[model samples]
Target chain A: MWKKSSDRFEYLQTLVTEFQDTDIEEAKEQVLANLANFAYDPKNMEYLKQLQVTDLFLDMLTEENENFVEFGMGGLCNLSMDPECRDIILQNSGISLVTNCLSSQREETVLSAITTLMSLLTPLSRSEITHPSILHCMLRFSLSESPRLRNLAAVFLQDCCTEEQVAQAEQQMQGQQTAVGIPLPQD
Target chain B: MAAPVGNSSGCWSVPEVYKHHEQRKVCISRPKYREGRKEKAVKVYTINLESRYVMVQGVPAIGVMTELIQLCALYGVVEEYRPLDEYPAEEFTEVYLVKFQKLTSARAAKRHMDEKSFYGGVLHVCYVPEYETVEDTRLKLQDRRRYVIRTAQNRAREKEKQERSNEDPTTSDTTTTTEMTIVEYDKTCDSDNTGEAQQTSYMSHYSSFPPLPLPPQEHNFYGHTNQQGNIQTEDKMGTLHNAIINTKQQLQKSTSFSQNSSDRDRGTEQRVTPNQASAVRFVPRTAHLENRKRKMAKEATEISLTDVSGKNEPLIGPKLPEPPKLDMEDVSLNTTVSLIRNTMKQVESVPDLKPLEKKIKPRRRI
Candidate 1:
């Protein structure tokens, strides 16, 4: 097991170095996919942290390249499950970056972003992660036509928000619907 | 007198006659009344000394003509105004030519209005030279219209290009491009796999070559696997182990490539031999593991043992036998009699307390 872990660590370090050395978009994509896969294993968490892979992933969240952002968010979603990695993400202001990804057109990217947010939400970060606009956005997402998006949004609301907060959001949404001249059906 | 020179039907005019000394002599031979007409001609020339036209640009979109006239009214009366109408409605912005009553008034308007902000844009006012005829101004306006139309078309094209790039990932063409690139990349990896397969084939000819590394892993994790692989029950774990080892080797090669590049950048003459590279990589991996193990052990000790023990405790306890019931009727009879006697004694004290309460209420009244 120790030998296997060392091998995995060396492999991930090589991928990061290759990613930095290459200028080709295709090569970068391959490297990022590999990094994201390695990130899923809990044993690689410390190795990745030493390589400053978290910062690299965070940097990709703002990239114009769709693949870069998607793979980056995927890696973050995987790594954020570890408590140490979660703390690192929070300290680096990863919440705002993950929040920005909520509007991504890619379903996989958005899903990963939501999970990353859920993982990073501690008592201290509850207010930042559950901002009013974010709550409203999630409320809208809960009613999405796609069941996947709707289910994820429902989970986010249930896990991240108090019942009173969710009820208040529903009232606000109803008020907006009425102001737009759309009537709601009574139960 | 040069009067006849001015009144001549087909002869030299007064100004023309004045050009030649001999012609002037001939003009002087004419009547004196023509002399008065020459004075009027000279007066007309002085009155037409400078142009009164002013070119005003940067007119606002709303009510441009009216607003321009109102803006110019402050300096002098506008004798006539012509706003260029050659530009198409959508592309047209404002530029006007106004004829003020005097040259001095045109100069004043230019000084007061040039570079001043009007509506949303700046106004540029300048005098139109006398040599610039209406035809020249019209041609200039047509040229401006063409330029504006060309630029508007270019802007629309650029905006469309940007939108296409932004929406590329969702489009089928982008997916095809990415797929094609991945297929090309896989071919290179396949070549490497074929070499490895050839080596492994000698061990067991019946076994098919191991599936390519790149495709199966990505799809498996993404839950998009489309094919199932057959593995012997005995070799299932062995194949999995081989696959892991292969991936790890590939990663080592990639990182070593970067280290080589970094070495080259540092202007070092020495090349990194495989032994040195492996040694350098090995040291960090072991050191990192040791540090992690230490940290985990420390955390384990820091956690209170009571917390772990408490979590293992059960909510319910063992059942015990119930106590036997006792007959209290005989023993309670004397206790009740004593309780009644004690109550009667207390009641006797209540009468004494009543007098104190009455005394206190009367003192309050006082």
Candidate 2:
């Protein structure tokens, strides 16, 4: 069984390369379909996960965007550990992908994706988030028409706001100790 | 020799298609099927990204269809890049950028590739029809999307029916009970799967989080994801990837291609849809952006000091010759607090010094 999976792993790497070939469009479909079957099958999924094949699957597939969204949250969560994986997600997927994932009509899936993307950022990146467009998207995402989507985007947006709020809270605590009334400055 | 070209700094094998400025050949060392050969870890793929997207959707209206031109051209192209100079000569070419972009969305990109032959595939080389605007692209995609999804949906239903028929008769009879269960495959979740993405919201602490598992249902979620998210995610990623590849290919295609290639869409800004705020704009939470916020905070402190310094001249100058020094500490955090504490300490110490001064001054005066 182990050997079979290892063989499949080796085969998947080849499939990914072959999938890249321009002439193998049907083969590409077959490869992804096969991988998808493996991905969807619970028995295989356990072994695949143990092998940490999600990362490879992400790398090899390179282009299964929407399918990835369902477990995007989990993918992002898993990627949070592997810095390279996280960077690839951010770089390839980018903010647009992030936003689209958040705003997806598939509320539960996109919510997880959005929140997970937000988590993937290192603390430094998390603190400095300032894309005004992201702010706008967050609003639309909150109105995601799906409660699950709304909450997910909200959680993500709130996470983005955390650093600023943390700084503000620290500032307010300092003001209370002073002799005279010191106003807590707002940004 | 004069320009000084040779092996790159890395020890591993690099997949170079060519050597000199003249003849470019990519010597990609295939991974050794045998064990223990060195140079196996180097990832030769131009883009080291895992997984891309494909979304195919019915454009409800021609109005939305108008957005297709931008979508068609810009969807899967690499948005972030340094420049062509960053890559080794002939070793890297963007010729397949568009086709590779289709890889992001298997079906949607495939559909687009079907219409526009970016390469000489099994069917023979074909040219993608030109789209001028989002609407043009959308109209084209809408027509294709409608046909694709319907066909896909039909296929999916048939496949499900077949699978159901193949199941054990005893289990099939229990329509209410599902024998299948959702499960996690590995340490990582596809995250790309929208079904599992929904539950990720459960972890809000943003620390020690887990990944989404595959969704279990009557329908094979993966089977339908192409029909569902394919045009959306796949089409976008494929177009964008193609745009990047095409840009490179065109540069190689003709001298005129450079002008067109340089005219690559400023899709970066358009692609960045800030959460909840297309009206407000979304800021990516990256380290540089975070550091920028810190710098902004520091600047705000300086501005506040400038204002306070402007007001401070009259009230502090005469009484406090050291006012400038204290004012200097205004914008700083820890130091400023310390300065204020020291100032208050000096104020307390003043009374104690007066009695000692009285004794010393009287003796001196006498």
Candidate 3:
């Protein structure tokens, strides 16, 4: 029994080290995906927390490569399901970084960002998460033509924020709204 | 963006086939330690990738929709099923979309049905999240979060119980490290009360996770420890037929409890009035737009009522105080003022009446 746990720890450590040492973008993406899939299992949550993979995922949010942002966002979305990992993400100021992905060109990335935001919700972080600007972004997303995006944004609005907040955001939207979730211009 | 798949009107639009639906090549070069029991492509599974609406492709076109649905019903209650006539398919094959009542049921159905051979056709199943409505998406995430939190709390409680039991043995020096490890290791070996012959092989590995606390009430209904380990060995041996036959029996027993509860809820729902039932089924797209418009209209009235100065105030900041009431020294004048004020309120409430009227119009038309 102990041997299996040690084997898992070693395997995760290998992936983490490979992610740091490899310069090739493809390898890094694969390893990032590997680590993220591992995070989905609750049994591996303690090991992932020990490896500081939360910080690794947070760092990927600001990269120029869209794949990095998407895969990393996906990893955080899965990891944040655990309360322990959610606290670590909150401590790292993950709210602002994840919010930046709201405007990503890739729909997968935006979807992951929305789910990660919902999972990152805590009493202490509620105000920042439900900030007027974020709510404004969700308001835009709730009207998105893509049903997946519309549904997730609706969940965020319905579950994460109060009805008054949504109403206020809607009112503000009519006069002047921020460009948070609008898609980036494609070259 | 993918088009909406189907609506409550029982009509389906052509669904855009997504990249995730195409299964990638199985990654084979992983070192022995990193490989899971089954070879899988390098893709991550998140809540975004899962849905109660699953798409099934490669079904034989020989009028087998009932047989296909019955196969799906083995996993859970099939809420809705329809063949996607517009979706592109291979020659002599068809595609179908099935919506299970619960996400877990969809998952189990996908796991069991995908890549399995049916009547002269191989089935390929994948989650089609684009087909879900906003309410379905919201309920899925809420249920997943609640399940994770509940399991985490249970695991933590079990750990605490194990620690307390270990502490009772020795109160002296070396209370911190070695003895605790030894005691935990010992418990793993001794805790296999399930003398099922199939479990004896992999019982050691399975013992570490679920039954760590050992005594009081661990072996009630969660046959997970029994099936998980035995299933793995069965997979490796290429006897999936036996593995499924053995596990399906146990899976159905555990899943039936949940099905019974859901069925009771469905029974109560059947008792609802037809109008209410239709309302629950058909959530109009215009509903959100109308809700927002209604709220805006109400806000406008509120602003107009509060700002007696008759100027639009910025929606932000503290609301303006109501204008002071005019007074008349004569009783006849005071009564006249009250009458005017009552007439003004009735006029002001006219906008509020519009929303209710609009609401009833949509319901009656549907």
> What are the RMSD figures for all models against the true structure?
38.6, 24.9, 20.7
Q: Give, for candidate 3 chain A, the lowest lDDT window spanning 10 residues.
A: A178-187
DockQ preference between candidates 1 and 2, better one = 2
Candidate number with greatest DockQ: 3
User: Best candidate per TM-score, number?
Assistant: 3
Q: Model 3: clashing residue pairs?
A: none
How do the predictions measure up, each by TM-score?
A: 0.35, 0.26, 0.61
Q: What is the DockQ of each candidate?
A: 0.03, 0.04, 0.13
- Encode model 1's per-residue lDDT on A1-187: one tens digit a residue: 2347676567667777778777878667667766676665444555776676777787788789998998889888767755446666886668767877887766567767876786676657776676655666677665543334555566567656766778876665454444324211110
Error of 2 at A105 (Å): 5.3
Better of 1 and 3 by DockQ: 3
CAPRI tier of model 3: incorrect
Candidate 1 chain B: minimum summed lDDT over ten consecutive residues — where? B315-324
Per-residue lDDT of candidate 2, residues B172-217 (tens digit) = 4322111111111111122322344322321111111111122121
List pairs with backbone clashes in candidate 1.
A14-B255, B3-B34
Give a tens-digit lDDT track for model 3, residues A33-149: 788877766666666766767777887887898878888898898888666577667766677678777868777888899999988776567777787767767776665556688
Ranking of all predicted structures according to DockQ, beginning with the best and ending with the worst = 3, 2, 1
lDDT winner between 1 and 3, please give it.
3
User: Total backbone clashes of model 3?
Assistant: 0
Question: How far does residue B312 in candidate 3 sit from its true spot (Å)?
Answer: 21
- How well does chain A score by TM in each candidate? 0.92, 0.50, 0.91
